[model samples]
Target: MSNLPQSLSLNVPFGAGPSGVVPGGAGSAPAANKDRKMASAEQLVLDLSNTELRENALLELSKKRELFQDLAPLLWNSFGTIAALLQEIVSIYPMLSPPTLNPAQSNRVCNALALLQCVASHPETRMLFLKAHIPLYLYPFLNTGSKTRPFEYLRLTSLGVIGALVKVDDTEVISFLLSTEIIPLCLRTMEMGSELSKTVATFIVQKILLDELGLDYICTTAERFFAVGRVLAHMVAVLAEQPSPRLLKHIIRCYLRLADNPRACEALRHCLPDMLRDGTFSACLREDPTTRRWLQQLLSIVGGNRVSPLQSGGGFEHMMVN
Candidate 1:
């Protein structure tokens, strides 16, 4: 399943965006000044090889947020070397192994992941990140935690970055992402991750299901179609077992996105009638009046043989007659 779908339409390559980052989006800078900035960014990336210099450079770049996006391409260029370095270090932690924080290594990779997160919103930089397999590089951070603050810092930041990656509207990005192990990884986070991890994972799940990849496309694929059902089941199960306000809110918000996505709602209708008929959904509906109303709206969107008024958000007025 490593191959992507042929239907994907990749955006125009990043080099086509702009020749240079216009400061404050004000205007283009002089050729000489642009050249100087590129030169400096290049040097800063090279300095990442030195632990002390890497920290300093990251600090400086963090202070100037726009500068980071401006330098996104340049930074992405250097990440290969950074990833190679990270790969060499992560091997010592065997499978199912808890990570013991390696301070020097953690500091370097954390900063690098942060930088990648900052640059990720750009379409071109996202393409670069995926091509570089930067997500795989960040995988080790999510699986382990440390008593050491630095290691914990890496895990938390990694969660946020993973969430941020799903914020794009690019089908090609999501298309490529589905070819990787990220979906399963997110499921794992939902199952065993910290509270914060669960929140970020929820955001990522919502974004991927509702925004990044069009629901129509996702529904056409057998695997993705089933995958979406599994996610909905897990979310409902989590809500049922240990009803927390925060988790409930995430699930509610996720469904809110689904309410507007008729294709996704249609897909859910096919799978959820069983849950609806068996009273599983009704049990959840009884949790609270406010939430019950939201669930009713969701059921209205997801009209079924039994769960009807057939008044879905997409206006299926004649559906009941059918």
Candidate 2:
């Protein structure tokens, strides 16, 4: 390969030397042959015409999980090629049109995508997926066929891949996803998904909302407490009604994080009573020490009083230094 550049000199003819050699240099034919062979092998790996073969290659690549560091350069080298293939597949298959992956294929793709996520150093590759408009491709599957057995399984796997991508940086592609009605779609999906799917949706939503950009968008859409109170009320009610310890902890954490903002704090206060009544708050109080501290801090922030359970004989004094 290194000698090819030298062999193909400006003086080289198309083909005029010893049997198969170029006019300008020796060994050009062998070098060109080797280069062609290498290109063919690479092309075979990326070719998507044979879905089974393409799927198998991805599966094999995924199995070599530890090699991701080594494979990073290759993935980067072929990033544009692979991204084009992915785009073509999504465009042709269209996730909405009666689904494509069988159980095995769905599992394989899910595992491969998950493994690929481990090397999400390729933000540009992720951006390619985003630019491919995968969210639009995925939204219909969330409601497909009323979430049947295998269908639901496939949907869950798809959501897992999408969720992983969203959680990567939260900034790389989320702004674009949110701009396209993905937020409301996700909220609706959370409302309708099975427990596992709901959990995934919850995590993604929390990641999105944790960022200032996402919170700003949510605030814009919801306006004030009254404007978004119904949505928050519904989310709080759902958490209260279903009562997953994991979800409860995350909800409390999100509230505490949001409470750092005065606007979010005011909005949260409107929903606090229902959240408390529904036992979401109590669930957190019982399950999370962090939540207990946050509650104490929240009390201090709101009430302007320092009542410490740890302090003994006298209340701590607040002194203003000049």
Local distance difference test scores for all models:
0.57, 0.52
How many clashing residue pairs appear in each of the predictions shown?
Answer: 0, 0
Q: Which residues of candidate 1, in runs, are more than 4 Å off? A: 1-43, 59-69, 78-98, 102-107, 143-152, 211-247, 256-296, 302-322
Per-residue lDDT of candidate 2, residues 52-86 (tens digit) = 56665566555654533324334434424346334
* 72-129 per-residue lDDT for model 1 (tens digits): 6655555343553454346444521555556675665566566767767666677776
Evaluated against the true structure, the overall lDDT of model 1 is: 0.57
Worst 10 residues of 2 by lDDT: 313-322
Clashing pairs in 1: none
Winner by lDDT: 1
Ten contiguous residues with the weakest lDDT in model 1: 5-14
- What C-alpha lDDT, on a 0 to 100 scale, does residue 135 get in candidate 1? 72
Residue 108 CA displacement from its true place in model 1, Å: 3.9
| lDDT at residue 258 of model 1 (Cα atoms) | 57
| Candidate 2 C-alpha error for residue 159, in Å | 3.5
